[model samples]
Target: MKSKNTMFLVQAATIGAIYVVLTLLFAPLSYGEVQVRFSEALTILPYFTPAAIPGLFVGCILSNLLGGAIPVDIIFGSIATLIGAVFTYKLRGSSKWLAPLPPIVANTVIVPFVLYYGYGVNLPIPLMMLTVGAGEVISCGIFGMIVLTALSKVKGSVFGKASYSK
Candidate 1:
């Protein structure tokens, strides 16, 4: 039990750090109206590890803080990712293809509103959806699929068989 708790903390911390680094890496592109957070690919990890729930939440929170997002965006944006990560974790073992969808959908649905209200973007809803959805499909879907495939090969070595069980 103690070891499991420690492992969870370690995973969360690592995920948070990686998220911060990745957000900083794309600082210019990740903020403002159109966001392409390549690090969001990690969101799919929740499908394989429950640790990804808090891991993704903390990661989003930290990344938002570092990225200088507005307070509302920091709070609600993190909530969006947290909700998506939890959903993904709950749906673990369903299908690899479906693992990344929750984050993509969550961000797509919530972020457009944020861009319009928060950033004062006057773009149409369809355009917002297209841009945000495209970024998520590329980041969380394409890149996430690659990460999922790579992790599948070393599932036992990294997270263990128990971690991958539904």
Candidate 2:
């Protein structure tokens, strides 16, 4: 029991740290209107374990903070990630293709507001939504699917049979 809990913590921490590193490494393309945070590919991790919910939330917060995001972005962006991850975990049993929808929708719906009001961007809300949604499609939809595929192939070897229940 203790070992299980430890493993969960370790996985979450590792995911969060990787997210931060990816975001920082691709700092320029990780934020803003036309952006694709490659770390978002990991959003699909929640489909494998509940640990990814908080892992993604904390990671987004840290990434935004260290990347010099405004307070609104730090708060709302993290909230978006939290919402996405929770939904992804909840919807995991539905379908593999559906796993990335929550995060994509959450970011699409929420990020435009942050960019317009929070950052004082001049783009129209609809346009901002389009851009953000496009980016999410690239990161969460495309890259996330890629990650899911790779993870599925090695689930038994990497995450154990417990994660294969889905």
Candidate 3:
């Protein structure tokens, strides 16, 4: 494979690994109907690099899988992350504040259904949306913004080129 491709794969894999770590580290708050997954903050990374798109998706997948999520949650939850990451990438040149909105909205909308049908959580969809939305706001909006701001400073250095030195 070319150096660029290799670098891209490495970046994506690293992001996925980090996502798994964060989700597992915060196991209690990383699952269930009311979850504040700290890993969701990494969803903002798509704004910096396209590699983050796949990275976040695969990361969510492994996180859910290892977190013992049900089949529906594993599939749908990852899809939400993937959709959010794609939109985030599309909005890369737009306002940074909007970067986190996609994941927040995606998760808020999709996760409630996963909770209700997948986990058999007994809660009104709207209520679940509210709770999930709140979590997303905390994770994706607030925490993601913190990460985004810090990453923006090192955007060129970190997301730029691979040294290709081995």
Candidate 4:
């Protein structure tokens, strides 16, 4: 039982670290209105492990902070990630294809307003929404799905059957 708890902590920490590193590595494309955050792909991990919820939330918060985002963007963006991760975990019993939807939708709907009110960007809200949505689709929808597929193949080795909840 102690070893099981240790695995959960290690997994969550590793996921969060990967997310932060990915965002920083792609700093140029990880922020702004028109952006594709590669870290968004990890949002799908919740489909396998509940640890992904807090992992993603903490990662987004750290990424936003290091990326020099405003307070509103940091707070709301982290909240958006939290919401998405929760929904993804909840939808785990459904089709694997559906796991990424929450992050894509949450960011698409929330980020435009952040760009407008939070950062005071002059771009029209609708346009920002479109751009952010497209980025999310690429990151969360396309890339996330690919990540999920790849992870599925190696899940038993990487995560062990006991790592995930039934």
| lDDT at position 124, candidate 3 | 98
Candidate 3: worst 10 consecutive residues by lDDT? Answer: 157-166
Against the true structure, candidate 2 reaches a TM-score of 0.96
Clash totals, every prediction:
0, 0, 0, 0
Q: Native-vs-model 1 lDDT? A: 0.84
Per-residue CA lDDT of model 1 for 1-166, tens digit only, reads: 8998898788888887887788889888777667788878899888777787888898898889888888888988888899789888877867778888899989888888888888789998778888988988988899998998899878877775534532
In model 1, how large is the Cα lDDT of residue 27? 88
Highest TM-score among the candidates is held by which one? 2
Compared with the true structure, what per-residue lDDT tens digits does model 3 show for residues 46-138?
Answer: 888889889999999999999899999999999999999999888887788899999999999999999998888999999999999999999
The digit string of per-residue lDDT tens for model 4 on 15-115 reads 99999999999999999999999999999999988878888999999999999999999999999889999999989888888889999999999989999
CA lDDT scores, all candidates in order: 0.84, 0.89, 0.90, 0.91
- Lowest summed-lDDT stretch of 10 residues in model 1? 157-166
**Per-residue CA lDDT of candidate 2, range 43-162, in tens?**
989998887888899999999999999999999989999999999988877779998999999999999999999999999999989999999999999999999989998886655444
Better of 2 and 4 by TM-score: 2
RMSD of 1: 1.5
Give the Å error, residue 8, model 4.
1.1
